[model samples]
Target chain A: MATTAKSRMLTGSKAMVEAIDQEMERDPRVFVMGEDVGKYGGIFGSTTGLFEKYGPTRILDTPISETAFIGAAIGAAMEGMRPIVELMFVDFFGVCMDQIYNQMAKIHYMSGGHVKVPLVLMTAVGGGYNDAAQHSQTLYATFAHLPGMKVVAPTFPDDLKGMMIAAIREDNPVILMFHKGLQGLGWMDQLDASIGEVPQEPYTVPLGRSRIVREGNDVTIVGIQMMTVHAMKAAEQLKEAGIDAEVIDLRSLVPLDRETILRSVAKTHRLLVVDEDYQSYGMSAEIAATVAEAGLYDLEAPIRRLAIPDVPIPYSDPLENFVLPNAEKIAEAAKALVNM
Target chain B: MATAEIVKEIPVEKARWMYETMVKIRYYEECMVQAYAEGKTPIFNIGAGTVPGEMHLAAGQEPAAVGMMAHLTENDTVTAPHRPHHHAIAKGVNLKRMTAEIFGRQSGLGKGKGGHMHLFDPKVKFACSGIIASGLPPAAGAALAAKMQGKNWVAVAFVGEGGANAGAFHETLNLAALWKLPLIVVVEDNHYGISVPKEASTAVPFNDIRGVAYGMPGFRVKDNDPLEMYRVSAKAVARARQGEGPSLIEIETYRYLGHFQGDPEVYRPKDEEAQLRKKDPIPRMRNWLLEQGLASEEEIAGMEARAHQEVDEAYAYARESAYPQPEEALADLFEPA
Candidate 1:
């Protein structure tokens, strides 16, 4: 809504760091801690120019100890310090899940409201540039399945900044997952939509909310994180093919905005859920279930889902792209549903 | 390098407290072994029991916990590994709540949310993780918090010798040393990590010497002697309290039980456990206490009886407590906004 002709356009990475910087300046208790988050400015550029401004006390370049640093973030948060800890990649959660899920997620609940952990766990997700099974994964569904943690993924620069500020200010632990493909990094093929006009002042887009990026009535196409970008493109393609599609970006997964999704299905009477995470028991399924339970009478056709199959994301570009949801896949799925 | 002499004498009251705590931990673990066996008599179904999960009993590792914890106060913090009962008991965690948690009762420490391996008692600043070597960083973080807040409070992390090889262990040591955090890393070298011996898993023979690589003084307690552990930890605790950074201490301890309650322990030699039992730290400390004139036999017997009574009361409390409601599973997942 702040976008204007004179507004400055920023990349997703710069917008994320700008939000963190503004918040750090606002609150002395806030700090950054993670591997390569200092001098390297984060492997994905999430913390660029922060270390030089904040110094070592604020911008801590930690060793490659995901378990220790992340766990330490939880400890610091419990002590009333707001720490923005990075896990480098979402695929590496396996090494430090105890600290993330068992400790960070459960400490507030385990303490029975006596202890409150206010921290933002930022991590890079998704893969398109042949990083293989280990480096490339968007395990958003895995974190959402577990209780006690708020999970969010932003598509554009503005939402990334607002949601990040909102995450840093939240009382509970929040996992801010950013996709690599949408980060606008120089090495990877970036999306033009990933760069957007961001407000200079710090703002917070509330969590647990969904945004209607494109509105139509023929079919409802819901996407999460990076898939939202693809859905917007697919909506354009569907228009050219004589079909009107509605695109919804689900920013938060834990407190899923089921009402917005149900309303879209009601108007469209057809549904297509797109996700970059695994197919089974993921966001796609959850969206389908949401529509089936509350908006079953509104649908004229069965909900179709486009996502990665239940297999390790291969290193080959063709294999990886084959499984990943894209504009073509979303457009195809929406056309099929509309025809039905 | 010269070895530090064990010249500092532990006070009579402190020695007695350690003895009683060690006795209490031994009895509690012994009781757990029995409690874990209930309802699984005909066939060993791990999921079908009063304590329905894998139970790791720290029966022979009491000295490592009591020695280090004796130097800590309630304000200090402790993060422990999967085998954490001795550490929790030594750190003054409430007995009734811990037992109820192990029994998955509603009155438990975590309200039956965290079981034996995942016990967390913030009142005494005690927490443990089921993952190996996972608690080290949090301990360092707590120490960092203490330093940042200008508190003299120190934090201790307990891990197994096998866990010493984990990346979390090394990373935390570096962080603690670099930041000058009041942290002490204690490794209970129980000779075996589950089924694999230390030789097979660890690159070095002693984890203590690895501290030198991280610019911290490391000491190895040769035998599982409570007095020796106390002597080594005294220096580390004093150093940490003095703002002299972290220290690593590895105590050569013994594990009497299998890795878990149901572990067959096929990899262990038949006579290995029996050999380790001959040098049990409990009786060794009892004899040392009597020889040093720190406690009388009557006092020792009284302490042992008191420990048994406490364990009995805790078990009763756990058994009498009720299970949480079935729908309560959805509760506690998130804090109410």
Candidate 2:
């Protein structure tokens, strides 16, 4: 007789770890390498319990040399071994951007399709934890701007589990940006969406698909990662005010689901793109441009963007809160778009 | 011009192969220079004809390549720098395909996407990059894969003296040592990085000595003798294969040509190239082979003839090969459906 274990709620970080564990169990070629990923169980606990389960051979703890380890992942991937390389923080891309952009991103293309780099580069992004400019910036837009890489930022626990598994199985190089605010760590504040029921079996929430988390007819609000949580809250507030709002969670940035966005905008007739990354030339602007270029005729008002106002994330809570795109700011932007 | 000491331990068969491989690299470079000149002369333009683009000739570093490459099989991986043709040839990359790649033909290693600087032959596990010091980290990765997969293969990174000072070099060496990865770091100390000399760029007098900081053995072999290079490289390769971790081997050599095809070369003294040519590895190896009774003069001549004929055939094949279609440019950016 088959025994069915009762499903329990898992935090986003736990779900992520479970997903990687399942993939590693399924494929022998899959392995993990990064700083503090072995004994410390990842700074964010995204790799918790992986080291004991997989051993040192698979769960490797690397030195603080991002360039070497990341490049090694690229090489291992090119040799047909799937590697999951983690950058401690998205803000640390400066040390190894060449390996990420030049080697990992362009090698397959530069090799004239002779090679394939199937690797997942996971990193912690966003700032609500009083970490200064260097540690707390959502730089997924910079990665998304680059071609040859698929950038994903999932907020919900289930989506995090699904995307992490999908990224590992992808043939193309993937950058998985996990928002710190959504990780549900005991040390940091958590979101309700972080603790949700995740399926025990392996599954993939296909990339390039935007989920309409909340449906309404007045306006469309788009958010990714941490901003998605704020957008959901903003929608709830807007509903209390009787102004029905729709929210979109953009899971993948490169293979963008512009159809879902445009379709939502065509029905709602308003757009408010919410992003935790910088405002200028970022995901916000990209969404605004996409809608303006393709779905302009369907819009009722000018597209509004609520994002970090092009400044470094400060350590002070008040300063960070002022610049960050929270529910109040997103709700305000949505109300302005509806008023316009 | 006989040296006092000769390495007699190398088998006669292995000695002959080394001599032939050196001859092959020399002939390939000779043919490349002529082909490069044909496109350069008659008004010396950058993108003139046939074999276009500026070339970084690897004419004098054959000893370092041949010595280390002698112990390597097709399963072994090598990451090379801009001046990479010598290492690629030594690693047994298809001569015809490499020639076609230089000619920008569809039958090339990268199907003409990668030029001479970025040659890659997956079958032979040969890869290169144009960026300085960029190859070391990838070679570490290749070694990491070999270790993780329980394979006996090792990855050799061919860097220059100047590249040893790079963050990529130090970081990769440290990681390789820490992980006990099977990586052989070869710094071909040709004493020049384009116009700048090694002394001006690097703090250390020797590159191999830096390996001490990473907990790996370091050795320097002076003069470009194939046998000496082979002996030192053999120990390093054996240490790596036995899971003893990485080693840095610096080969003292010189470059006969300028860094690139059209380089004005105002940095070096006028007699420097002529002086370095006196100790050229190719002629020295040939003389050593004769003195050691490894091969007859006629046999040496026959090896040279075969090298010349092979390069000539490769050039002809490249010349007759078709250029990739314009739409083909958009094809290789992603995998085929």
> DockQ of candidates 1 onward, in order?
0.43, 0.64
Worst 10 residues of 1 chain A by lDDT: A1-10
Model 1: colliding residue pairs: none
**Model 2, C-alpha of B207: deviation from truth (Å):** 1.2
* CA lDDT of every candidate: 0.89, 0.88
- TM-score of chain A, predicted model 1, versus the true chain A, to 2 decimals: 0.98
* Model 2 interface RMSD, one decimal: 1.3
Lowest-sum lDDT 10-residue window in model 2 chain B: B1-10
Q: After superposition, how far is residue A312 of candidate 2 from its true place, in Å?
A: 1.5
Per-residue lDDT for A1-340 in model 1, tens only?
Answer: 4454245899999999999999999998899998899989999999999999999988999877787789888877876689999999999999888889878888767654556789999999997789989998999899999988999998889899999999999999999999887778998886797798888888899989999999999999999777888899899999999999999999999789999999988899999999888999998898899888999999899989998899999988789889888999899888888887
Worst 10 residues of 2 chain A by lDDT: A1-10
lDDT of 2 at A283: 88
Q: What is the TM-score of chain B in candidate 2?
A: 0.96
